[model samples]
Target: MHYALNVYGADINPLAVLISRVRTARKVEFAIGAIGASVVKRARADRRFGIETTLANRDKWFRLEVLTELSKLRRAIRSCEELWARRFLWVTLAETVRLTSNDRTSTYKLHARPKHEIDGRNVSPIDVFSDLVSRNADSFAFFRKKLRDANAVSHARYRASTDIALVDNRESKKCWADVAPFDLMMTSPPYGDNQTTVTYGQHSYLPLNWIDLADIDPKVDTELLRTTQEIDRRSLGGRDPVSNEEEERLFAASTTLKNFAEALPDTPSDGHIRLVRFYRDFQASLEAMIGQMRQNSYMIWTVGNRNIAGKQVPTDTVLSELMEHAKCSTVTMLTRRIHHKRMPDRNASSATMREEKILLLRKR
Candidate 1:
């Protein structure tokens, strides 16, 4: 059994104990993806279902198997209510619809800025939901009701479980406003300036602003406040310039980032600086994360090597380097090929990133 498990690990990227601990959640997510993929494939195959075919063969086959397995894995996820899965499925279905749509209305138009080229048109949430309904009306109806009930139950539970008192620290000036013990920790840190795709500042703005859990208290100290505020500002539109001739030289020397920079138009000064600062901050976040975990705690992150300027910026490798510098141990690194369905080659000329490494680490 041990030999078999080790071989499986080798095939999938060596699985660390930390990652193995979350096998259940990973399995559930895999199952869900499988089921969702199958539904989409079957729908596309039967044009009578009105679902258009937008996925490549690789994606279509992957989704069919993963999504179908998800349908079967529904029985195994602990503490997972049917409603949660249903809601997730509905959301995924909506995404699939958007992915397959031929209309261009949904694509983001950056004024003179880089835009992600997708298939024909922008697909809407409604369109996806409609597709789901047409294809699986019975399942659709079940999830709809289940989602409503789940929200109600979640709200009640949050109101009833008052173990950790909420303290506002929005305005706080401290290295970390508060430190709380976590049961498990998983994160995919930024690879580097050139390799990362998801902008942390832009991606997190709405959630940080709207969610009460992230509310800042007025009593925060000045230093911490300024630091966080600067971060927020950079996220919005701030960019930090590369500090010296040395740093600029380093960036220029990077085969990965140079390509990305050349491919991308000159970013607004503020935005450019923010990207650099964001990576620096990401490293800090990793360090802080390691510090916060208890001894022997687990950390699993999904990262990858991004291609920039015809060279690869292995984010997984960079992060491992950072973790080691912070005195953390490298547990395992799993390389996986995930055909991102949403990443479309509109121009058919831009470099595409097709694979990612799932890095698993442990804090000793």
Candidate 2:
């Protein structure tokens, strides 16, 4: 909407896709304040006391009181007549769950707080949800005002096409073919597999359990929430045992990758298999994204080098080489210092990088 251009995006994470859709939806109601108040009022009046989620070890992650309060909020949000408003409320509720749950907020993994910490905490889910709703509603109002100032709003709707879907780019099928031949592509692919780099799925697991799956996408399977690590496991390269043919194709396409692999010590402890599998999946995803771009289109990729076995993987160089191999030429590369990007500072498998590389390329 900022540029009044049609936009399309895809992600394998259902929660991510839902948030994207809610934020980019063409028709959005401006009465979030009234809607939020109504939700809170309804939740306060609600007498239902049943727990809503069957997440494994639910009691361990949430106190009994917290679970009951959250269930009331969920039921109230579901009662809203408008789907868009309900989706917006759900996002707010997800944040509230993150704040009120026993899980520590500092880490992506779902580690529960100590018994004393959990017991001493005086958090009220309803209060957190109410505050969040008010704050988020204000933010949305400001955003809408800016869009209106920019003349991007027409008849209370955004003036451009917006499409967001839950799509796994590694799949062979061109799920985004309907909107193919894009003139510009910009993305920040994961630096490495989510398990080692960032446990995004685990971070989302708790909130997802309380959220209505149908609100996210009908195609999203409940099996993804069966375990805290299920979503991460389904992510790129999360599943192990990279095929020899895939390794060969990836290494053949990017000499930098081959050299990096060759440089690793021949030991299971060297993280050789993990590195190869991640890059193989990365290459496949890159190919799928590039295939949808129009000839001569510009592509901007933001990537970061990750460490494996105390060695830095030159992700920028490897990505450039891979793009070149795919008949794309690098236009320029820029380096930016990371200021506030969320990352694990002490991950055992991968050390944090202080900077990121942005590569500009043109499809040939």
TM-score of each: 0.42, 0.96
lDDT of 2 by residue, 1-364 (tens): 6787898888888888888888898999789878998899998898989988888898999998999999999999998988889889999999999999999988788889999999999988998999999999999899888888999988998999998879787773466767788899888887686777878798899999999989888898999998899998888878868888988889898888899888987665737888988888888889888888899999999998888777788999999999998889999999998987777888855564778999999999
Q: Report clashes for each candidate as comma-separated counts.
A: 30, 0
Superposing all C-alpha atoms, what RMSD in Å does each candidate have to the true structure? 14.5, 1.5
Candidate 1 error regions (>4 Å) = 1-179, 190-238, 242-278, 344-352
Q: Please give the lDDT score at residue 309 for candidate 2.
A: 73
Q: Which candidate comes out best when scored by lDDT?
A: 2
* lDDT score, candidate 1, position 298: 72
lDDT of each: 0.38, 0.87
Q: Pick out the ten consecutive residues of candidate 1 with the lowest summed lDDT.
A: 6-15
Candidate 1 lDDT by residue in tens digits, 11-108: 10111111222221111232444454454454444322221222233232223333332223222222234433443443344334324322232222
